[model samples]
Structure formats: C-alpha cells, structure tokens
Target: MKCSRCDRDAVIFIRYNGEHLCAEHFMEFLESRVKHELRKQVDLKPGDRIVVGTSGGKDSTTTVYLLKKIFSMRRDIEIIAVTIDEGIEGYRDRAIGVLSGYLKKIGVEHRIYRIKERFGKTIDEIAMMDKTLIPCTYCGVFRRSLLNSAARELDADYVATGLNLDDTAQSIIMNFARGDLDRLARLGPHSVVKEDLIPRIQPLRMIPEKEVLLYAILRGIEFYHGTCPYADLALRNQFRKAIDEWEARSPGTRHSIVSVYDELKPLLIERYRNFKLNRCEICGDPTPGRICKACELRLRLDKIQNL
Candidate 1:
C-alpha cells in the first residue's frame, strides 16, 4: 500500500495508527518527533556539552544518529557519546564494538565506562549473588548511578538518553497508579532541574519503540538486534507488553497516554513541588527521601555480600 504521507510504496504499516510510512517519510516522521521533543525539553545554550547514554541497541544508536543530525544544524552545541558497560558478558562487549565503530565513523567523541572495573561487580554477578534482585533492576540501578557519575566525569552539561514514548508513558502510569506524585512530576522530557541532579534529557520522548527500530533499520545503523538476556524476567516487561497490546488495539494509545501526562503536568509539578527533596545522606544526590534509590540498593547489596 502507498503511504498517505509520501504517496509512495510503504514498507510497513503502523497498525495502531493505520498510517503508512514510506522509507523516507518514516525517517522524516521520526526525526520530526525527535526534534520537537529536544527543542521543547532542552534549552540548549552555546558551548553546551551534551553526553548521550548510548547502548549498542537500536534505541540508543538511533538517538546518537538523530542527535548528531539535530546538533549539526546548530554548531553552538558540542555532543559526545558516553556508553556504560554493565559487564554483561557477550551482550555489552559486542554491542560496544558496534557502538564504537559507529561513533568513530560519525566522528563523534565517545567513551565507555566499564562497570566491573569501577564497581568490582558486574550486573550479572550482583544478580546471581542475590536471588531477590532481578538482573534488569540491578542493571538499571547501576547504570543510572554510573551514568550520572560518567556524565560528571565527562564534564557534560546535560545527559541525554534514548527513552522513547512508550517507556515514558508506562512510567507515568506506574507512578500515578502508585501515587508517586513526586516521580510523576519529574517525568517530563527533561529529567531533573535540581541543582544536585544530573539533568537527564530524553530527545525521543514522543517517538515509539517500533519507530525507533524502523529508523535504525532504514538508516542502516548498526545496532544489536537481540533483547538483553535478563530482560524477559523483568517485571517491567509485563508493563511493556500490556502497553504494546493497548497500542495495538487503539492506534495512538501511547501518544494519548503521554498527552494526558502533558495536560496534567502543571498539576503534577505543583503537587510535587512541596514533596520535600533532600540530598541523599549517602551519595549527596537528590532524593525525595533520606537516601537515594541507587545508593540504597548498592548498600543493600553490600550488606548482603558482607553477611
């Protein structure tokens, strides 16, 4: 079938929205969404060093590709890629090779921080040591803490990630359902504005996961195709599948979900404004409670190992 946007033969059908996107139009559509989100969330200033948390996966690789394109139009901002190696044997090692090659080919400055070397424990090691902790959970906790530390080490003014629309929407629903207004308030395209927080920026906040994959494929960007071996066992996977099903049945359901968050953003912000954030007693990072989540998990692991 011909795409309605380009009147060309469509490569794939976005069933949720019944929109046909030709190869070129598909890229354009995804790029436009990225650009809109970036321009909206990031107040880029001259000489801003933006570090992207690139994984060797489709989402992150596509993020690097688009960020490069977007920043090229404005020469004032400097961009670099910072990859966190979670020390997941073949998974991270192989992906880093592709990521490094892509960054080298694109002439983007990049660096990888090996978590095993830094933390003395790989995510898999930690997960295996503690049956209660899931692999992705451990990986996520370590990655966030390490990403912030790496961003600071790289002298980055802002840290950008490849979190897409579905991830953000699912997080929103989870936060709201749990009455986590503070987290919900901080759920915009821009990560955190607090002085102690390493500003997290999501450029592809409005793009879908499928669109990201399609863009990577269409652009011939080299990205790891397989899921993280530990991802299937994750509780987040259930939320992901549920959202995928909803989006499948109701085209644009994910977009609508995000839109509701956007519409209610002011209220969320106001409500969470008085949530009383204090510096984490352990890590000196921003936290709604006494200790930051990352440090708390790390301490728990430490106690477990010591015991």
Candidate 2:
C-alpha cells in the first residue's frame, strides 16, 4: 500500500483510523502520541524523578526507550527503570537478561526488586502451594506492592508503566464487569497522589498493542518476546480475548471504550473523592481497609503453608 502521508511504501495500516503509514510516518505517529500522552499525564518538574516498572517486554521496553528519548535533553528530569523479578525462573530470568542489557545500552539507570525477597515466596511457589486462586492473583498483588515499594525506596515523584491501550481497555471492562468502581476510579496515569503510594503515569495508554510491538521492532529496541507461562491463568485473559474480538469487529472499539472511560473518570473520581485511604497495619501501604491486598494475599499464603 502507498504511504498515506508520503511516497514511500507503507509499513503499517493503522486500522483504528484508516491510515496507511510508511516506516517514517508510522514512527512519528506513534512517538508523537506517546509524547502527547506523557505531557497530558504528568507535569514534570526540575529534579523530579520517574521510576518505570519495566518488565523487559515489548510494552515496557518501548516505554523506557521512549521516555528516555523524550527526556534525554532535559538534564534536570531523571528517569530510572525498575524491574520486578517475580521469581518465575524461566520467564523472569531470561527477560531480566534482555532488560538489563537494553536499559544499559540506552544509558538509563535500572533497578530490580524481587517478590521472594520481600514476601518470602515467589509467584511459582505460591502457585504450587495454593490451588484455589490463580497465580495472577498472587502475582498481580505482589507485583504492584513491590513496584510501589520500589518507587518509594527510590524516592521517585511518579511511577510510569507500560500499560498500552489494549491493557487499559481490558482493565476498564474487567473492572466495570466486576462492579469494582472504586478500583476503576483509581486506574493509572494517575494525576492525584496519595501518601506513600506513588502516582502512575502511562505513556502508551493511548497507543495500540500492535503498534507498540511494531514500533519496538522498527526502532531496533531489544525487549524480551516471551509471555509468562502463567499468563493464560489470569482472569484478565477472558476480558482480553473479548476485547480483542470486539476491537477486530469494530476497528475503533478499544478507543471508544477508553475515550468513554476517560470522559467519566472525573465523575468517578469526584464520587469517590471523600473516601480516604488507610495505611495497612501490617505493611504500611495505602488501602481503604485496615489491610492492603498484598498483605492479605501473603497472610493467605502463610495459612496455606501452615495447613
């Protein structure tokens, strides 16, 4: 196909908007949106540090790459990449090898925190010990908790993540489906900060997953291509498949879902504004109830072990 904007052969067909873009234009299209997203998500300041929760995957590597690309000239703003090692040996170990090399090649400072180091168990061990809940239940809670703690220890002003549009849409529908309005209201690219809990910023929240992959490839970005062995066990898999089907049927469905959610987010936030977060008595993390979800899962794991 001919490039929609130039004479070069098109490298991608942006189905959502019906544009056939060549490599040059495609990269420009993707990076420009990411740059815009960064600007819209947070207001950067001198000496402000951003800690990125990088997982060495396409999305995360792209996130760290683009963040450095955009802020490379700003000596005052610091960007550090942090990876969570969930102790999924075959999965996380290989990815970390790629992640560390990539981050170093890009000259971005990288740090790693392990779930087992903090919680006394890895995701794989939790999966083997507990049969009722999925590994994702433990992995998600532990990963989020570790990321927040890592960000705090690094003294970061904001924590950026690699949540692209597909992930964002899936989360929205999943939360809405489960009647988790409180969680939906508190979804990422967070502008408001709660004490001890770092606000999240998503630079690729508006970009599609395929585009992120293609951009990573085109830019010669090195990221781990493996999926977690336990990925299929996630409750989110159902929503992800359904949303993919919806998006395939209707080119713009993903955008529509996110756009609608973005429109209603302010109202959702306002409705829940009065609700206050209490520190978890066990771990001192922020939560609505007396205990946070991570600590709750840890206690569950401990009980299972005792039995």
Model 2 per-residue lDDT at 282: 96
Per-residue lDDT tens digits of candidate 1, residues 164-267?
88888889877877787777878656544766566888888888887888788889988887667787787676778888888778788888898888989887
Stretches of candidate 2 off by over 4 Å are none
Worst 10 residues of 1 by lDDT: 188-197
TM-score, structure 1 vs. true: 0.93
Count backbone overlaps in model 1.
1
> Which stretches of candidate 1 lie above 4 Å from their native place?
15-18
Q: How does model 1 fare in lDDT?
A: 0.82
Q: What Cα-based lDDT does every candidate model obtain?
A: 0.82, 0.93
Model 2 sits at a Cα RMSD from the real structure of: 0.7
